[model samples]
Target: MLNLDVVWTSEFAANKWIMPLPADAIPTDKMIPATVNAATYRDTLVGAPYYTDGALFYFRSDLLKAAGIAARPKTWDEMKTACKAILALPAAAGMSCYAGQFDKNEALTVNFSEAVASAGGTVVDAEGKPTVNTPEAKKGLNLLVDGFKQGFFPSDAITYLEEQGRRAFQDGKLVFLRNWPFLHASLSATDGSSKVAGKFGITSIPGTDGPGVSTLGGRNLAISPFTANKATALEFIKFFTSEEQAKKRLALSSRAPAYASLYADPAVVAKRPFFPTLLTSLNNAQPRPKVVQYGATTKAIQEEAYAAITGKKDTDTALNDMQAKLTELSAK
Candidate 1:
C-alpha cells in the first residue's frame, strides 16, 4: 500500500517505515517497541498502530488439575507430556490433545512461522535470504509434523483455521488451543455460546526450549492518499490511538492496546488480568518476513508447511522446497 500510493501516512511513535512521518506529530514513547518496528519499513513512519496481537496458549485448567499436572507447560516438550497424561483420563475420551490454525491459508503461515521461530530458526532473514533448512528449522517442523503423524493433534486439524479451531475448543473437543488474543473475550463471555467460559486459562505458547516466539498480528490505521480531507483523517487517527481509546478497546473486547502504559494501569490490569503475559508476548513476537511480495512469500510457506503437516511431503522435502521458492520470490 505504501509503494502503490494507496494510503496516507501518519507520524506516530510506532512508525518505522522507509517513508518519513511529519515532524513532531506524535511521540511514541508509550507504544510497544516490536509493534513500532513491524510498522516501520526502512526507518520511515507510515502507520499508526491500533491493537497488537500475539499467539497465546489456552487450555482446560480443570483437566490439568485432574491429570495431576502441577502447572501449565513451559516448553513444547513439557506440553507434549502433559497432553499424554491428560488424554489418558476417561473424561478426556474422544478428545484431541491440541489444535491450532493450520488450514492451508495465511493462518497456516503464521503457525509455521511460530514453530520455526520457537526452534530459533528464521524463515527469511532481514536481507531476504531464505533460511528454512537448518537443524533448528527441522526441529520446529517436526514438533508439528511428527505430532500429527503420531496423533498428538487430530488428523482433522489439517483443516482448521481460527474459527474452526476455536469452535473445536469451545465445544470441548480439544484440550489445548493456540490462537490470537481476540478469542479471550469471546470464550470468557458470560453468554451461553461459550461452553468453556471460566473453565480455562491462558498462557504463552510453549517453545522448544521455553516460551515460543509469536508471529506479530494487528492492525494499523492509515489514511488513503486520495482522501479529500487530510486534516479530518489526522484527527480521527489521533482519537483512535489515544490512551482513552486504547483502554476502551481493551475493556470492551480484550483487544490489546498499542500503548504500553495501559498494560500497567490499575483499572486496565484489573479488567484484563493477563496484560503482563500479553506484554511479554508482544515484546518477544517477531513480525512476518517484511517483504513487499508478502502474498507470494506466505503462499510459498503455506503450501510446503501444509504438505508436510498432512503427510503429502516429508519435513526435509517441505522445508527444502519452501526455502527454494521463498528465495525465488524474495529476489523478485
Candidate 2:
C-alpha cells in the first residue's frame, strides 16, 4: 500500500501505479464527501480517503469585540468593513488586514485555487481543462492583486509561506489570516509563544457572496498495483481508516478526521472547538485541480498568480497568460 496526497490520486490512477479500490469494501459513505471525491479518479474509487484538511479564517476576536463588531464576517466586503473598524482602534495601529500563503511555490497554487473557487469560478473544468478567463475568475484573482494594490495585504506578504503567516497571526500583527487547521493548536497554546492565545476565533473562509470554499488537503491510502497481497492491503486500509482508529489519531495528533460523526462527537468537540466550523468548510471544500500533470499545472498557476499579485503583470494579462499555459498543459 502507498500513502498519497489527495492531489496524487489522478496521477497514480492514470499511470496505473495504483489499483482501483472496490467501492463495496470501503466505508466511503461515512467519510467526508469531499475527501471521498479526492480519492476518486474519473468516477472510480482509486484510494481510501484518510485524514483530511481545509483552510479556516482566523481572526482576532478580541479586536473585533473591542471594535464593537458582534458578528463574524461572512463575505469579503464584510471582512473589509470589519477590518476598517478594527484598524482604527489605537491597539491595531500597525496591523494589516489579511495574509495567506502567497510565495511562488505550491502554496501559491493552493491560494490561487481557493481564490478562484471562492468567487464561484473554477481553475479547471470538470473535464480537467483550463477555464480561468471568465469574469468570476478575474474577480477571484483580483482579490489578491487588489489586496496588494490597496494595502490590505502587507507588502512583505508576497514572501510569506504558511509558517510566516501563522507567526504573524500568532504575534498579533494581523487582523485576519487564511490558513489550515494545524494552526489552531499552536494559536490556542497558553504559553507566551502565542501572543493572541485565547483571543482568536476561526470560521469558514469568506467569499465574494458568502462563505468560501477551501482547497481540500490530506492524504489517501492506495494499494500498489503490483502488490501480491491485495486482500491484506485492503484489510489494512480498512483498519487504518476505521472510526476507532480515526478517533485515536484525532486525540493523539489532532489530525482532522475523515468521518463526519467524529466532528460532532462530544469528546472531540470539547477538545477542538473549531471542529463544527471546520466540518462546514470541509463539506464545501473543492479539491485542487485533479490532473495527471499536477506538478506542471501548479507551476503554471504559481508563476502567473505571483506575477499578478506582485504587480509584475496586470490581472488580465497574467490570467490570459495562465489560461494559455494551462491549455497547453491540459492538451498534453
Candidate 3:
C-alpha cells in the first residue's frame, strides 16, 4: 500500500517512510516513545500503532529451579552455560538448550535481525547502505552459527518457525525459547493441553553483552491516501489508537498495547504480570531494514544465514555472500 500510494499512511508510517505526515494525525502523548519511534520515519509519523510485538526470553522455571539455577541468564554466553548445566541433569536428557526461528523464511529474517542488533550492528543504515559484512554483524551471526555447530541449538531447528519452536517449548523439550509476547497466553492457558503452564518465566532476550535487542513486530493503522472518506478514516484511526481501546485490548488479549501507561495499568498488570519484561524488550527492539525491496533482502539473508547455520557455508563466506546480495538489493 505504501509503494502503490494507495493507503493514507498514519503519522507512524509517515515517520517510517521518512516523509511528511499530517501533524494532527500524530499519535497522542499517551503512546510509548519507543513504539512511536518505531512507527516514525525520517522524523515523521505515518502510522498509528495498534499492538506491539518483540522477542522475549522464555525459560522453563521448573527446569531451572530443579537444576538449582538461581536467576535468568543475562547474556548469550550465560544462557548457553545454563543450558549446558540443565542438559546435564538426568531428567533433562531429551531437552535442547534453546530454539528460535531458523527456517529459511521471513521469520528467519526477524531472528537474524535480532542476532545482528544484539551484537550492535544493523543490516542497513538509515541511508540504505548495506552493512552485513561488518565485524559486529559477524560476531552476532557467529553466535547462531557456533550454537548450531556446538549443538547448543538443536540440529532440527533449521526447520522451526515460531509455532514449531513454541510447540517444542510447550512440550517441555526446550529449556529456553526466544519468541514474542503471545506465547505467554498460549502456554498459560487454563486448558490442560499445555505442559509448561505456570512452569515458565519471561525475560528480555539474552544479549551479546547483556539483554539482546529484538526485531519489532506489530500492526499499525493507516488511511488510504485516495480514500473519499478521509474524515471517517482518521476518526477510526483515532478510535483504534485511543487509550480506552488500547486498555481494552491489553485486558482482553496478550497483545502488548502501544500506550505506555497501559503497561502499568493495574487491570492489565493483574492479567499479564510479565508486562514489565515485555516493555523492556520493546524498548530495546529494532525494526527490520526499511527498504522497498525488504522481502528480497530478507530472502537473501535467510538463504545465506540458513546455510551458515546448517554448516553449508562458513561464517565469513556467508557474511560475504549476504553483503553482496544485500548490496545488490539496495541498489534497486
Clashing pairs in 1: 8-223, 13-28, 16-40, 16-41, 17-40, 17-41, 17-44, 18-41
Location of the lowest summed lDDT over 10 successive residues in candidate 3: 3-12
Candidate 3's TM-score: 0.92
Residue runs of model 3 more than 4 Å from their true location after superposition = 1-20
- Report the number of the highest-lDDT candidate: 2
Tens-digit per-residue lDDT, 1-332, candidate 1? 22221111222222333234453444466789877766566566566677778888999998999999988997888988999999999989999988888889999988998999999998878765789989998998888898798888988898899999888898889899999877877788787888889889989998999999988888776555556776687677778778788887765676687788888899887877778888888889988777667777888999999899988999999999998998888777
Angstrom error at residue 307, model 1: 1.0
The TM-scores of all predictions, comma-separated, are 0.90, 0.99, 0.92
Candidate with maximal TM-score: 2
* Higher-lDDT candidate of 1 and 2: 2
lDDT of 2 at 87: 98
